[model samples]
Target: MDDLARLVATEDVRRVMARYVYSADHHRWDDLAALFLPDAPFIASTVDGSVQARMTGRDDIAGQLKARNHPDSVLVHHLFSSEIDFESEDSATGVWAMEDIVTRPAGEPAGMHGYGHYRVRFTRLDGRWLIAELRITRLRLDWTY
Candidate 1:
C-alpha cells in the first residue's frame, strides 16, 4: 500500500476499535453491529477462565451481548494502544490493551470491578473495515484482587 492508503487504513482501523468500546460501554447494540461484517465471529472470555463465549454473525453478537450486559449498572470498555499489523490493504490484525470497569447496581457480590486486554483482527470488506474476529483476555480481575 502507498503512504496515503496505509495511513487511511490505519486510521480506519483505529476508528473500528473505538467504536467497539464505545458501543459496548454505552449499550448501543445497533451501532455495535455496524462495526463488524455480517458473518463475523466474535469471541469474548475472562482471563480467570470463568467465562468463555463465542457468537457468530452480527445479529447474534448484538443479541447476546445485550442480554449479558443489560442488568449491569455501569460498564465502561476503554481501549488503547490499538496498533494494526496489515498484510495488505484488505487484511489486518490489531491488539488493543483494554481496561474495563463494571459496577453492579443490584448489589451483587462482585462489586465494582476491572478487567483487561482485547486482541482483535480486522478485515477490509467492500471498502470498509470490519472486525473479523475478537478475543477478550483479562489480565487482572479486580473482584479477585
Candidate 2:
C-alpha cells in the first residue's frame, strides 16, 4: 500500500479498537456488534488458566459478553503501545498492551484488576474497518473478594 493509504488504514484500525474498548467499558454491548465481522471469533484467556472462552458471530459475541459481565459492575480499560502491521489493503494485525479494572457498586461482590495484551486481526469491508478476530491473553490478573 501507498504511504497515505497505509496511514488511513492504521487510523481506521485504531478507531475500531477505541470503539471496542469504549463499548465494553460502558456496557454498550450492542454497539460492539457493529465493530466486528459477522463470523469473527472472540477469544480470551489468562496465563494461569483462570479464564478461557470462545465465541463466534457478532450477536453471540455480544450476548455472551453481556451475560458474563455483572450489571452493576464498572469496567475501565486502558490500551497502550499498539503495534499494527498491514498485510494488505484490506487486512491488518495488531497487538495492544492493555490494563483493566473491574469493580462493583456498594455491597456488590469483589472485582479484579488485569494486565493483558490483545492480539487482533482487522479487515476492511464495505468501506469500514472491522475486527476479524480477537484473542486476549492476560499476563497478570488479580481478583479481590
Q: Name the best candidate (by lDDT).
A: 2
Which stretches in model 2 have alpha-carbon errors above 4 Å? 49-51, 105-109
Candidate 1: residue 72 Cα off by (Å): 6.0
Taking all chains together, the TM-score of candidate 1 against the true structure is: 0.87
- Residues 43-105 of candidate 1 have per-residue lDDT tens digits of 767666666678888899989877766465577777777767888889999888888877665
Q: How high is the lDDT of residue 121 in model 1?
A: 83
Model 2 clashing residue pairs (backbone):
none
Return the top candidate by TM-score: 2
Please write out the lDDT profile of model 2 over residues 1-145, one tens digit for every residue: 9999999899899989999999999999989877999999999898875557898989999899898788888899999999999999999999999998988776766788989899999999989999999988999989866
Which residue pairs in model 1 clash with each other? none
